[model samples]
Target: MKRIYKISVAIVTLLAGCSKSGLLDKDTKDSIDAQKFFNTATDLQVYTNGFYEMLPTYTLYTDEDSKSDNLIPLSVDARVKGARIVPPTNASTKWVWDDLRSINFFLENYQKCTDDAAKLKYGGIARFFRAYFYYEKVKTYGDVPFYNKVLSANDPDLYKGRDSRKLVMDSVLADINYAVANIPKEVKLNEITKYTALLLKARICLFEGTFRKYHSLGDHEKFLTEAAAAANELIASNAYKLFTTGGAATAYRELFARNDQDATETILARDYNTTYGRQSVGYLMTAPTAGVYGIPKDMIDSYLMKDGTRFTDQPGYQTKGFYDEMQNRDPRLTQTTAGPDFSVYKETTREPVNLSITTSGYRVIKGLPSRDQWGSLNSYNDIVIYRFAEALLVLAEAKAELGTLTQTDLDNSINKLRARAGMPNLNLAAANASPDPYLEYWYPNVDQGLNKGVILEIRRERRIELFNEGIRWDDLMRWKEGKKLEKPMVGMYFPGLGAFDFNNDGKTDVFLRTDNTTPAPAGTTSIINVNQKRLTNSTSGNFNPMYSTPCTFDEKKDYYYPVPTEDITLNPNLAQSPNW
Candidate 1:
């Protein structure tokens, strides 16, 4: 499939985009003076916005929904059961290159500023933005170019290369350190800050060090230990506090809806609205009738109960239909997902709300605006880029990787997340259940009982806390658990519903997933297996050999998205990730 976007950034003549400096028009060397642009507040504001302009590329890394759904399969929540991505071509990779290049470009000239505060503030923001880009790159591709200054076309060793992932990590960590030391402690709701930089450092270090150690990267434990140390320091600082509310919906639904409320969890957010740019996660997830997006029925199954039972696992779970399935579970589920009974809207005197229950029976609420947000003035919500929940989860992952986490460790990390959602704290010792079974499922390769089930607990918190924030893909990757299912996509079928009987035939709905399959009555293209006697993919669309049902229980390699085609071309030196 053709990649869908290109950078609108202007390429100044006489300059070349540098590997380290990124995609600056490069006129800084012998052409336009960098000082001219950095001299005024107006210039500084406009210049600062250039970094924000590239934010769209970061989220656009997904591909077509079907017909070789590549990045999107991983980008969106399509690969849980067994979805696959199309091949990566040149166009798709350029975006990553351009995104990184934009930040490098900004930082290259940002230093030329004569004003001290502007230099620190603007430079801090630039470094933080650059670090953010590399963090994304590192998460997806392990190593990358670490350019900090403008490089000229004639510079020798133009071919002399990408630093090791470790080296890149050093660069990322250093920039974050610099940012924390320079920017203001209290940047306005609309701006980046010193605390933002430090918080970002906590996130990246935690993610990088934790993920590597979890996957057994070189010096794995060393990285994780350092990452955990970094996270704990942030926790100890108490510069930010958890967003807490007493109302039933105040726990999480409040933070999810109020984008800019500084709950201490949010590290940085991509601002969205009708005017400044908007988030259509709702439009993309809810059906057309909902004026937003809709979550498929398969995804809704991933939610676990307060007692940690899957809806399907609970006795008599299927009878109550979705309302009961959704009830008494995490309250965040209702806030994140819309059920048939949901009737929320702006207010009276407003046009009729055009929401539907969705063909799959779910709606997108998290990151969506109230009906009144449309038109005129922009919706002032911050698209959460980082939240404290991640810090806790990262720490949990780091501790688990170290295999040194304790009951108390799990309590503070994952259990606290569960408590936030009103679920019982996970207890490994209380019920006399050894964490061994969970660990065997998780770190089967690790020696006898070192993992101790902390990984699963970490995942549980993430699943409940980070839903609909575009985090699942990254999640499946770092955990290395996105592709366990053979058939990733499948249709949804109730026990006996939606079965089509052609010619008014009575017996036409049976299907199976093995060779020598049999087709049922007319119009029913299916067969029955000795194991499953009920309906199959006849009328319900559940028999795709390729697609995996959302939560059919899985883990796999197609989890990491293909580095966009455009990114590859911009940095041919960089290679496609394995299994992409």
Candidate 2:
């Protein structure tokens, strides 16, 4: 196998103890040579991998930060203090305040040193990484300082912070442009390919440009047109195609499972294996005993049938509930969630643990350590940040918004995904799903010509295609429609393995619940006993917690997340998002 290699530049150290006195107490910065440090071939190896690994950790917004509360995951430590989601303090804001620090470092210094193809390669890597990082910031924080140069801590100009959303976006676009121009179109055999940078550009541009255009922030139509054009260029390249049939369960599932051998759709992935990055997010979310995390009910419902109908809306879906009900439902769902008797699983270790979910009711089998190696706790799987499938979706969305989704759009956009699944094209009119109808509800001025609804459908495609690969929070934020949609978190809670019974569905054999005891235990009276379910305080109104809870789209206030208080203090000129 031809392995993708990186240029490894060894870390050079400055002589130690320069602060003591005399020769040893000399200034360190003066003694160290900045130019030679970055030029080392060994430095690029570590730098490149570090760049790839950092993408997932970039947390302007993450699922945990957005879930339950507008802070990091509700930690056990905080709950003990009787306070929830420790408010944004200065320390909490370091990452937020300094997200651009590293990117700026590389950008300002990359070109000062070497033309040694090896060092220049790292330059290209840094450019793409910086742009990619800024792209994420734009998506979350709106306007940010598009710093292309490193700033000093003592620089008096630090107070000149904040720029309008448009400025940041345009600058972001420019960086991607530079990246595309400077980076290769294809990398023969390397960790980060030349084609990968181009693909990243296409995706970032289309997303930002379409979002601006869809929301009518500024020259949206112009950007959308340009984005569509870029997307089309990628489509015509034909270097990638849909991963169809024999590809279904095992191959399709393995694509994200991080087995590099099966990464057909993956354009750029954060590879973790033999090396301890992470494997099977399953254990983190599954019923613990099952050795993985269970999938959330809402996540499970996101997949569409192979025929494009919702699993619930399909024939026998209600009756069979879990029988791959709609033959048309996207195969990705099965690959993501565990079945009533989930079939596609591999054993990696020999320990004997409960693969079945006795308490939580459902468990995730995808991306878990292979079944047999029960004791092999760690599993290595790569997370795909950019994939060709996403590129296709972006193309379809931009084209649909620009005008009617042309025949080519069908072939390139939705059809490619369907083709991979051996399904037919969606007759938009026949499907009775009008793309423009949401326009009526979204904006009153039809002349605005903003068919954000089309973009929302594209957003929907994104949700289904890339379910819970740690993107639900940002995906919800990016869409004008999701921001507008009123789907509240009104889904049922499965407070798995706790005394807190969300709702007792015990009466119906179809569902399982712990039920309320006749006498009741201390601190457990909050639930009402009925059937086998206990209705808890989490559900108070019409929406049954025993079944589903509430998630409403509070348009007036919920759009932008609040800026961490610490960030506001450091950058006084920066303004908070509206209504935050």
Question: Each prediction's TM-score against the native?
Answer: 0.72, 0.73
lDDT of each: 0.52, 0.48
- Residue by residue across 502-572, what tens digits does model 1's lDDT show? 21224443333333444444544433342322124432333222332344433334534455554456556
lDDT assessment of candidate 2? 0.48
Cand. 1 Cα-lDDT: 0.52
Worst 10 residues of 1 by lDDT: 61-70
- Most accurate candidate by TM-score: 2
Clashes of each: 46, 60
Candidate maximizing lDDT: 1
lDDT of 2 by residue, 1-580 (tens): 2233322322212311122111111333542355665555565445454455345531211233224211111121222112223236534331242334444554555555455676557777777777777777676557665556544444545546657777776776776666666565663322555567666776676666656654567676666665766667666777565555356545556665434533456565555455544343434433333332334334444456666655544453322333333134576666655433344345433222232331223344444444432233354444455567876876776666666566667676876776665556655444324543422443332223343344444555666665545555554454454432332222224323233322232221232224534444343423333232322333222112223322454454354445666556666775665566
lDDT of 1 at 70: 18
Give model 2 RMSD, 1 decimal.
7.8
Candidate 2, residue 576: the lDDT equals 63
